[model samples]
Target: MTSNDLGDFLRAHRARLRPGDVGLASYGRRRVAGLRREEVAVLAGMNTDYYARLEQGREHSPSPQILDAISGALRMDREARDHLYRLAETLPDGHRTQPRETVSPMLSQLLDGYTNTPAFVLNPALDLLAANGLADALFSPFGKAENLARMTFLDPAGRSFYAQWHRAAEAVVSSLRQATGCEPHYPRLHQLVSVLTESSEEFAMLWSSHTVYGKTHAAKELIHPEVGTLSLTYQSFDVRGAPGQQVVIYHAEPGSPSSQALSLLGSLNATRRRESTPER
Candidate 1:
């Protein structure tokens, strides 16, 4: 069992809840902002010392009953509950891991067909395996790293590119955590995690929270250096043949400012390509 991860997850979720939020009276000056450890233990219907031990990484395995109670006490949503169970290695269903990192030709063709959309494929570790022209243009500011997590946490351009930089950082870390949990033996994942943890305090803090999630579908606000701010939505799809690969496509509303900006970006890219081509 991932004892340290389980403990960290419990502590983070516990810290996210407040006494008043859980229908308890907030009396006396509190030392912390969130619910206390004893309060969580009481709500979880377990001994305070036992829960404390669990948080201290001394107790690894808790029964499904205890986990359920803790989930309830922490007010976890469906996704968060699934993540907590994963951290405890108590998930009912097993997940498939990526055996290799190659993007299929069919998937590549599909991405290429989406001429107007910014489409790309990523591995479990958020490494870019394949990208269409629009995506290449969109992510050009990230340089040639080809890894989203590293670019977000390590690259200074990431702060300006993602309008909601903090939200983007948290989501990337959470996604990485989910991926690592699914495939614990990926060496590159470990290396990436180690580097980010050691280099970026923000990444370190978010990693310690033990959040786990995939970027399925979400609205994004991005500030492109040339195109300006764009309000776009994206969908992430799992590649069935490749277990841990995801195909992500970004879209904007028709006739909206975002769509116009995207068109302008495409035009600019075409112009640059033409400029680079040799006259025959």
Candidate 2:
């Protein structure tokens, strides 16, 4: 990574925020956009010269305490904070030291038990390592699904499948940014980023922002070909024993129309399973 990368990232996020975002009053016509370097330094409780040097890549070693203060001052979320620490080569709190690429059999079985919910396991690169039948059905729109990042950016159906297409696409790229910070040497991730950046202009733009995010729990809307429109809440868990692997499960509110639609899809899936099983 270039020395300017960290500075660029900080500048980009800083440029996106306004004075009012961090509770600073907007007084006069600003000569430059967003919060100025001095404003950030004041908010972070550090010297303006020091903060400016950091942004200019001249200040190399910032203490963890300083990083923490800056993160809060910048109003960075957990994921973004982690990214900041990682970019600076400081060990982030709760960052997995070991990144596993494969899912364990026990976890795979655990996923299968969630019959009513769509559950799948993904690696740092967003490769669909293991998925339950419901997840398979849920993602069937991307025929022969391989990687979530690829499916989201490459396939035309992705725009239709993701009801919040722009948000979803942005989040996907941000997640990839987080993954890149986690494991910079992963060849597959490098290839995926290259392909998406080359193919999709939207992806290229978001990727350039250097925003890092990880999927945790969020509301998602999907327009499924078979089940129609369904709103679901997804929760992501880091597989403790597996390090880099994350298990994501999707569910709808009980007794909701989306829930009923999911049930119908499950029933159809069950019938298809039975039909495919030879007489025994």
Q: Write the per-residue lDDT of candidate 1 for residues 148-203, one digit (tens) a residue.
A: 99889999999999999999999999999998877877878898999999999999
Q: What CA RMSD would you report for each candidate?
A: 16.0, 15.2
Question: Which residue ranges in model 1 land beyond 4 Å of their true spot?
Answer: 1-97
How well does model 1 score by local distance difference test?
0.86
lDDT of 2 by residue, 27-112 (tens): 77788878999899999999999999989999888878888888888888877887888788887544334467777889989999
Consecutive 10-residue window with the lowest summed lDDT within model 2: 91-100
